[model samples]
Target: MIISEGSLVLFFFNSDKKWLIRIENEKKLHTHLGIIDAGSTIGLEYGSHILTNKDKKIFLLPPNTYDFVMKSQRTTQIVYPKDYGYIAARTGLRNGSKVLEIGTGSAALSTFLASIVMPEGHVYTFDVNEDFMSIAKKNLEKSSMDPYVTQGIYDPEKIGQIRDVDLVVIDLGDPWNYLDIIYPSMKSGASVVCICPTMNQLENLATHFFHGGFIDSDCVETFIRKIEAREGKTRPSMRMIGHTTYLGFARKVLK
Candidate 1:
């Protein structure tokens, strides 16, 4: 497995620490282990180990969307992998599914969604903040998922312009505010997933979904805990990723 140029690579120091960077021969990387000449990595096989000047060993590994999200630059809070996984699985998003993503904060959700619905489908992500969109564009470009996503810098009030989407994902403080606009644009039986950080928002969202003619509504909070696998000392990790946000799911049902 040759490490290709422009490929995202991970230098794992340990389970807790790693560096995610694009393979650029012209650049050099500086870390606590020491400085690494990037040009030297051009022909190295993945899983190969290299020793730094300080005699620290590092392993080259393939990178994934999760790594990209964790390492990508962010101007706002991002949706965690745990929540995105649930959204993907529950919504049954697949290749060729048109997705409408509201609130393109850091593009983490869009990046993951684009990876799933590429070559045949597309994601139209909307945000009012041009600055946020600019950062998001960079992230998508870095992930090589830019071709699969269409980002626009427009006010959320203009969401009425979007139409015929298979899935609608809302990442905002008040998802209820857009329900009216989203209802007409969504296809029948289409799934709507909302991420709310507070109970006040959840209550408003659930109420709005019910009255807005969305059925099969369910709200769930996902928590993930990792367990240590050391022999004779295997136990749950002391620190676990917990309480990112509450997810609300519903299906469009025209009255």
Candidate 2:
């Protein structure tokens, strides 16, 4: 397919450096590799190569959900794909599954869930920080997942309007405090996932889940290390993101 305006493209230079860009009619991207005429990419077939001014070869590839989430403009720390994989598996979220997300940081998880729950389902994300929500809105828009998402600044704990949510994802520092507030909005058999950054938070959340209207509680911490998959030197990358956060999963049981 031909490249077009607003199309997301991935420019791969090497394993260490790759850029995700939104194509525009009149734009130039300056990088350490070279200056690339973003407008010149129009009409080029996907996977085509363009030579930069500095003779650097730039290969253009269509970006996927993972690329959009990773390359999204970040105002805060985002949930990495490794954790997302576990969350998705634990929750079994899919198309037509309504999701409620608290603490829409950078909207990475929001975009991921919105992409999966398209055509029939929606994601309602709330954040107290308007600036963060604004940044997240732009990121979701760039990924074309905004249509499936609803962004708001109201606190999910105090909001009385949301109801029948299939999944509730709590990304707040004090997720346990919101468990009582989130319980009423979720439907029976729905799952609630919490992202905790510290052991203290996880311990508190565990205690809350035990007392709250929840069952089958489980917790996990995800670790990801990318390997250099090259011939003769295929091994794990020396540097890796060892710890991001802890994830706690539980199912809401109806009274």
Candidate 3:
């Protein structure tokens, strides 16, 4: 859409993108190419096109969850949207589904979960560090998904009580240690996903999953590659962020 005064827009590009900027009468957008009158974009729809003074074209689109999560100010490594999407889809998170997450980090995944579970579902997130939790709470408040998030500055390891939840996702160093605590709190057939960086951690967690009365425990890792498009040659980009972490998934079952 055409970005007008006060309209939020996502600039689509292979790499460079930004948010914020207001269209005002006689205002201009300064780019390396040149300056473009902001008034020229005032009435465009979402996902429209505009030309800079240098004749460079830019596409504007409505911001999605990915856009916000990737751009949110983060003190810790934020979960990528690819992994976040997998967790949300596999866990069947939607309105009315109660989800729990540990190690809120920057609350990137928590924000995604909150978006899908809105108007009914709720997201309860625990972080041991109050500083991180406070930052996450502020981040959530600025996003559209804030209503579904309940942030708690408590250590999940020491949490003595938890309600039945539809999904439990752990993003901490020792998720396996909490399986015992998480298992009983999960509703029957509820899904659990864990994010770990090492094979040893995944292997060790698998053993805990079986012993903890969980089934179908599996591990997965996602790799993403982007392609560059130009006039003559279109090929995969050389650099990629490979092996962020491995994901382990399991389901709670009646013993």
Against the true structure, whose TM-score is highest? 2
Poorest 10 consecutive residues by lDDT, candidate 3: 13-22
- What residue pairs are clashing in model 2? none
Q: Which regions of candidate 3 fall more than 4 Å away from where they truly are? A: 1-6, 20-44, 49-55, 155-161, 229-232
> Which lDDT tens digits does candidate 1 get at residues 80-161?
9888778888988999999998899999999999999898999999886778988999999988899999998755555677
Q: Across residues 1-255, which tens digit of lDDT does each residue of candidate 3 receive?
A: 355677656655436555433456677767665665556667888777777768777776787777778877798887787787778777777788898888898888898888888879988899877789777876787566778888887654444466789999899889998888777678999999999989999999999998888998879998789889888999999988888899999999998
TM-score of each: 0.94, 0.95, 0.83
Model 2, span 79-194: residue lDDT tens: 89888878888998998999999899899999999988897999999986888977898999888899999999856545547889999999989999989888999898899999
Report, for every candidate in turn, its global Cα lDDT versus the true structure.
0.87, 0.89, 0.80
Best-to-worst order by TM-score is 2, 1, 3
Worst 10 residues of 1 by lDDT: 153-162
Measured over all alpha carbons after superposition, the RMSD of each candidate to the real structure, in angstroms, is: 1.6, 1.5, 3.2
Q: Measure candidate 2: CA RMSD.
A: 1.5
